[model samples]
Each structure stands twice: as structure tokens, then as C-alpha cells.
Target: MQSPAHGRRLDAVTGPFTPRTPRVVAARRLHRRRDRDTAGRFLAEGPQAVREALDRTDTVVELFGTPTALDRHADLAARAARADLPVSEITDEALAALTETVAPQGLVAVCRHLDVPLRTALARGPRLVAVLAGIRDPGNAGTVLRTADAAGAGVVVFAGDTVDPYNGKCVRASAGSLFHVDVVRAADPGAAVAGLRAAGLTILATTGYGDSDLDDLVDHGRLAAPTAWLFGAEAHGLPEELTAVADARVRVPLHGRAESLNLAAAAAVCLYASARALR
Candidate 1:
């Protein structure tokens, strides 16, 4: 008989599933980058991310959880019912074993990769987009994506050899914002920049040694235009060649003793600056 709660028939989850169960084992495989890439699927754990996944079309491949988790997140199950998505109740042990987090939060969602092409995102004529060039930190990259979404940027572009945006840690750090924004993975940084320029967006390269101060740009109304902010890896910042291609080298004016802002912080400051100016 189908369970009225989830509107799907599930096995009587007698106890925790063995770690060797086929479904559990398949989910465990996603812990590896290669497996995720090969499957074209990644895991989104916890209620928040899972909820966001359920809300998006064709994103959630499967939903798994323990009975307690499903009950705790009944709203999500209800939403899934409305969307005609199937939900399964796994054992707590199986849930924990399938995810990297110490606490599995009772639910996990397998979702399709959301990466789009750089040219496609650029073709949208975004008022603001973040171009992350070689940002290697998953936490920082995810935070930037969240910040860009909060700041109303039309999209985010991960250019060059940046960390995979679909990395588990990155997905967790995004805190549901991953579903709220269009994200592009650009294999070619140079070509990505060219596309942005062709779209008529002012490319502002952020660097510690930039020529124009961020405040000056805002005060001068320089940021009151369609723009894409170029941010680089924390260790090296933007390369000289990349900066040379930008319309301006912009820096955040820091008066404190703090040496530098972290990548995520810098991106937030830059993106919000543009958001404020353009308003």
C-alpha cells in the first residue's frame, strides 16, 4: 500500500539499511568527484537545499531520508507530492553513510548538474554577473554564488580552473542559493571574458593593487552600468593578462589594519557596490 504521507509506495523501512545496500552504495559513490561527473548528478543534503531542489524543475533525481527526517520535514514531502516527485525513507545509518556531513540532517537529494555555458549566460544581457577566475576554495566559491544571488546579479560564471561548483562542500555552503541563480562554468577564461565584453558589460577587475578605488568608482557613478566583476583565486588574485583585458582595475578601500579581504568577502563588497550604484 502507498503511504499517504509521501504519496508513494515504499518498503517497510524495518531498520537502518546496510551500508552495502545498492542504493546506499550508489549514493556513496557521489562522494568522489569522478563519480559525480560521470553520473551528471550531485547530492544536496539537508532540508533547505533539498527543498530548493524540489522547487526547481528537473533538478531532483531522487530524494532519500529517514522516517524521522521525513516527518521533521513534512512540508518538503508535501511539496514533493504536489510536484509528483517520489520520496524514499532510508535508515538513519544509511543516510549518514551516504553523506559526507557528520550529521546527515535526515534527508538527501540527488540533483542534476546546473552548470550552463558562459556564452549562454552572457547572452542573457545580465545587469550584473560575477566572473570567478580560478577561485579554488569551495567555501568561498559557494559563498560568492550566494552573495551574487542576494545582490541580484543575473548570473555567476566560474571561469578557468576554478573549483567545481557542484562539490559537496560548495553545495552545502551555498545554503540553497545555488538554485536561485544561473551558474556557468567556463573552461576558457579568455574566451569567457571576450563574450562578456561583447555583451557590452563593463568588466571590472578586482585586485589589491588596482588603480581605481572601489569607493571612487561608486562615487563617480562608474559602477552605474551593466558590469561583470572579475575575481580571482585568493592566493594569486587576478593574473596580469586578465586584468589588462578589464575596463578598469578596481580596489576596495580598506582603512583598517586588516591586510586583505577573503575572496568571498571581496566579492560581496564588489557585487553589493555595483548593486547599490546601479540602483
Candidate 2:
């Protein structure tokens, strides 16, 4: 329904929600990783993230946006309306307070954590998976998740001391792919590797130092089988113990003078290689 005030085409009326508003306060609490973990929810900003979060059933708990943001993205407003989700009109300052970005997207959605148990992800015979083993960068982790989805991977597991997939930067970096693929966070890297192997996935660790070369594996047509690619932080590759558990440690052959590829690029090359071989 259109607001009767000043012939505004918006559905919201009355006062815009502020940072101090109780519900807004609760949503704002998600800004911290600890509170988000405790509440089993995280914040997704921008119209794209909010729209994607809304697409999944029961994924979005509440959506808050500025009047201008809602006005600009009516399709999102309609989607929220169809879900019967409460769309609170929030002030700009409130939105900035809820986000880590200097330029707030003007829209934010409180979403249920997107991760599933590792077994659930490995079940159903996944042909391709990306395991972020001790990945410390949220941006890289998110980028790898996006690349995994694009490369036809069915799941992405965040293992060991990896950053939370729900980190604000990570969620934004995923570009909504967080909702597109199965995500797993395993605190124990060893058990995660074992589970992947038990599920019949060949665990390949991507590292600068490896006995096997990725090109050789592809050339030999060894990439057709179900595979899980393990990626680590760029500065320091996979931990020694984690690397030891891998079925094979494979390095992407650098034909160039450059010594190594960053985490995201390496993951894309490895995942796409398997995707092509599988097809």
C-alpha cells in the first residue's frame, strides 16, 4: 500500500528505525562476529545481498533499509512484501552503524547462518568441492566461494582457523554465491579431510611445494573423479598437518616468472580444471 503522506509511493510510515530502536539494536549486535555466532545470524548488506538472502526460504529474518533505498529498489520491496517480512525504515546513521563499510549500502538484512554440517555437504556425492584450509582472508575466502560456484562446485568448506564465511566483507565478496552453494565450517581440519575422503572425494591440496603438478594431473585425465581442492592463506600455504592428510599435494605449474598465485586465482584454476575434466 502507498503511504498517504505526501503521496509517497512507499509502504513505510511513521518514524524511521534508529540505532537505539530495540529491533535495530538487536540487528546491530550482529555486527560483531561473536554475537552473530551466538544468535546464529549475520548481516548481509546491499540490495543484491538482501535480495539473494530473501530468495532463500527462512534465510532472512528481518530487512532494514532507508526510505530512499526501498524506493530505489521496489522489486526488493515487493519480494520482502511477498515473504511478509517486516521491512523497517531505518535511518542512514543506523545503517552505517550496522555495517563495516564507510559507504553503507542503505539496505541490510539479518540472515540465518548459511553453513551446513560437513557431512551434509559431502553427502549426495558431490563431484567438486573447495576447502579453505586455514584461510585467513575473508575477501579471498569469499572470492574462492564465488569461483567455486561458478566452476560448478557443489560445496565449499571453511576448515580450521579460517575466517567466518559470515564476515561482512566475506558476504559482500561472495556476491550472493554464499546462498548459491553448500558451505561448511569444520573446526577440526583432520576430521574434515577424513570425512571428505570417506565420502569418496579425492582431497587435493593446492600448494607452492607439492610432489604432483596440477597440469600433469589434468593431462593424465585424473581430474574427472570427485575432488576436493584445499586452499590456504597466500603468505603461508596449508599447515603441515593439513597438507600431510591430503590425498595429493598438487601445485599449479607457473609457466611465468612469478613464483605463485594468490589463493583465489589458484582455487579458480584448480576448480575449473576439475569442472572441465568432469564434464
Candidate 3:
């Protein structure tokens, strides 16, 4: 088992792990979100997430873990070593303070945020895409991203007012799929829909009261065209502007009187259905 007393010199490396101090703490918190957008940097924690980041080392800026984490995640540490990443040993207390969760997984990483241009995302040749509009829950946002990836979506776009994709909870909920998918934040919902249409992608918005039943509107044989699936926040369906721009408005047929599906579940159902339809 590795311990903080390992031969690695704590002061010799670059990235955020060089030395543990008040300054590093303050910098991490302040730059967590702002730097995410401007510098294209984000944070990842836990053994699994850190391992994933190490596999894609070009994306990692720094790696930190406690003695136990190093011992428990030897393979990850080996990868980090091969990547020449700055790896540092910190006290459990220090790791806990840097993380947002009550039980810190003893490992965390600073990574370059993925900047997938809207144009590039649209060009991915997706037969289906999922566009989330104003969904505020971080868990829902993450789950939707995971579902999109599972359904082989071309991309996942976040319209105005959606939760931050890098939020700790959202990142964890994504179970590392966040690293595999193209997720973009749009300036506005209307503009996003317009861009999709301009790319020759069909826009289909999901609504409980929609006139067209989803099953009837989607034809497996005719799914060759690029398509974007628009999902609304839980409290309200897609905004009026989005609904108005959609080429088609469709609904999932419900047998029970359940008011509506949770945003994440609905997204999964919609994405899976689209995948099946296209197959």
C-alpha cells in the first residue's frame, strides 16, 4: 500500500498538486466554475472517475489522492505515472475539504473541460439527439447525458437555464459517460433549435399534451434523417419558443393517470424509443 511518504517529491511537479496550502484551496473553489468555461477546466473525483481521466491523460491537469486511494487504486496510479501527471498525496482531511460530498472518495482530478462546438456537435451524424431545456436538477441532467450516450445519440445540448454539467452530483450521476459524449450549452433555446434545423436535423419536442403520439409519428424505416429530441423541465414542458420551432410535437402514450414522467426517466424512455425506432 502506498503512503504519503512515497519517494515522489511533493514540491517538484506542475499542476495543482505541487503543495497543499490555503492558496490552492482558495484557487480551486474560485476557479471551479469560472475556469471551467474560460480555461476549459473541470474537477473529477472518486477512483472510477479518476481512473477514467487518467486513461485520457491529455485532459487531466492534476491528480490528488490520499494514501488509501493510492493503495486501493494502484492501476490508476500506474496510469497517472505513465502519463507524467503531477500526482500528490494529501491527508484525508484535505481531500474531504476539496470535495463537495460528505464522504470524499479520497481521489480527485483537475481536467480540461471538453469544448464541443455547437456546429461540430451537430455534424456528428446523429440519427437522434437529446436537447434539454431549462432542466435545473443536476441529477436529472447527468442521467439524461448517460441515457443519450447509451442510446448512441449524436450529442446532448443544454439550452438556456439548464444545470451545470460539471456540477459534482451531475458528474457522478453520469458514471463517467460525461467523458464520452458531446455536451454543449446553448445561448438560447430558440437559437439552438434554429441551428439544428439549419443543419438539416428534424426537431421533435416531447410534450404530455402533444397532439401526436410518439409511437405513431416515429417510423423505424424513415429515421435516416438527423433528429433532435427536445425535453422540457419537470415543472413545465418545453418553453413556448421551443415548442413553436419544433418540426413535430409528440407525446409518450400513457395508460395510467400518472401526471407525467420525471424529466430524466422521460429522457431515457424517449432516447431508448428513438434508438429502437431507428434500429
Candidate 4:
């Protein structure tokens, strides 16, 4: 449908938009970190990610989808209507142009960045939390977020030089767990660790050189207390300075000849250990 005044194609039901429109251009720019940061928004693509974003209605700025995609996800459109958010239907060409993925799931949503501060997260008095210290890999970071959410942890902190939690890859890797947990970023890793300690959370640093073993902590019931697990990068592990301040440097015991667990695997083992102990 063409607008009477503007002469632009607009779908009444789906709010059809053109590829070169200002709204579309701005949303496409979210593909860049600088633009996303500037607009305080990021794109959540695919049915699951968009649905999850809509579940947190206040966080979703706008939703875009194709007519066919909206029909398939009728419930999402209905919910969006209930929340008073219109689902903008755009041309397939425009949707394809908006994302970097080879094939999109036909839906995209612009969501307000949902990260909080370390102080706010600490003030919640969270019981089980995962702290990523200087983790650069977005996949590893997102996997940890999902694992933390699954283990019933309270929050996931991307501390220090961690990847942007709102990055498209990280968000997709989280598989909607991004909306399930309280995510935060801390520019200063040491300060974040100190804050956690100050909040009465026993810091358990995962390191190869740790004095305490993870199994011992679980078997001995040491993980029952409110604790924060500090996970470093996949390649280098935790920094010595950060581990030095932790209440306990805990290591996952390996039975086989394997070198060590990857970042995500290590996080799953550690988080579930705490979850079981706390249960």
C-alpha cells in the first residue's frame, strides 16, 4: 500500500517498510557495535530470539517480520498486539540486507540493550553467579550465560574485557537465555571481584593452579554458600592477580588424559556443581 502523503509503500497490517527508509537504515546499523551502542539498541533475529525479546516487552523497541513469517508466528504477533507493539513487515530483500547471517529465520527485533551494572547485580545478593573475566569469545560468553540460566544461577556477569553481551553472535548463542538472566558488564575486573566479595559472595576462581578441587568443594559441601564462579578466557584462563584475591581457587579434576575443558564445558561443570551443592 502506498501512503497518500508520502507516496511510500506501507502495509497497513504489517506496516510494510522500504529497504532504504530511515527506520530500516538505522536498524541495519545495529549490526555495528558502535551504532548499537550509539542507539542503545541491538537486533534480535529469528523466531525464538524475537519471541524471547517480546516476552520482555519493555525491553523491545520494535519488531520486524515478513508477512509469511508473522503468519507462522501468529502467537507472537498477537502478543505484540496485546503489548501495543506493531510488527513491521518488510520485503524479504530488506530483511536479508539487514543481517549478516547467511539465512535469517524471517524475524528481527530491535531491543534495548539489557545490561545492568555490577553494583546493581551484586546488590541483589545473588546465590549462584558466573563471572567471565576478560573473555573475548562471544560464543564462550553466550554459552556461559545459557549455562548459568539453566543451572538456576541468579545473574551472569561479563566482567573486564569480555565481549559485548548484546553482540548478534553472542545473543544467538545464548538461545534466548539472554532474556532469562540478569546480564551485566564490568569494565574494571578487580573492582567487580571486590564488589562481589563485599556482597558476601564467596569467590571461587576456576584455575589450573587452584588449591581447591571442584569435586572436593562439592563433596565437602563448600559450594553451598552464596558463591560467584570466576571464569577466565579459554586460552589463558584466569589472570593471577584476579585469582589471588578469590576466596578459593577451584580446579576441575580430570580423570582422563585430556588437557583441559574448553571455556563452555568448564563453565557447565562448575555451575552445575554449585547448583547441585546449593540444592
Tell me the spans in candidate 4 whose CA falls farther than 4 Å from its real position.
Answer: 1-15
lDDT by residue for model 3 (1-279), tens: 223333222543432242356534743672356656665677788988887766663787777777678768767766676676667776666676667788878888878776487888877776788898988888888888889999998688888998778877888888887887878888688888888888888888889888778777655343446679999888888898888878778888887998888888778877887787777
- After TM-score superposition, what is the CA distance of residue 181 in candidate 1 from its true location, in Å? 0.5
lDDT of 4 by residue, 31-57 (tens): 888988899999999999988888784
Task: Write one digit per residue (lDDT tens) for candidate 1, span 167-248.
Answer: 8888988888889888998888888888888888999999998999999998899999999999998899998879999999
TM-scores vs. true structure, each candidate: 0.94, 0.94, 0.88, 0.92
Q: Residue 76 of candidate 4: its Cα lDDT?
A: 75
Ranking by lDDT: 2, 1, 4, 3
Put down candidate 2 lDDT per residue, 211-238, tens digits, no spaces.
9999999989889899998888999999
Clashing pairs in 4: 11-16
Score residue 107 of candidate 3 by CA lDDT.
Answer: 81
Which pairs clash in the backbone of model 3?
40-113
lDDT of 3 at 20: 58
lDDT of 2 at 248: 89
lDDT value for candidate 4? 0.84
Model 3 gets an lDDT of: 0.76
Alpha-carbon runs more than 4 Å astray in model 3: 1-23, 30-32, 219-224
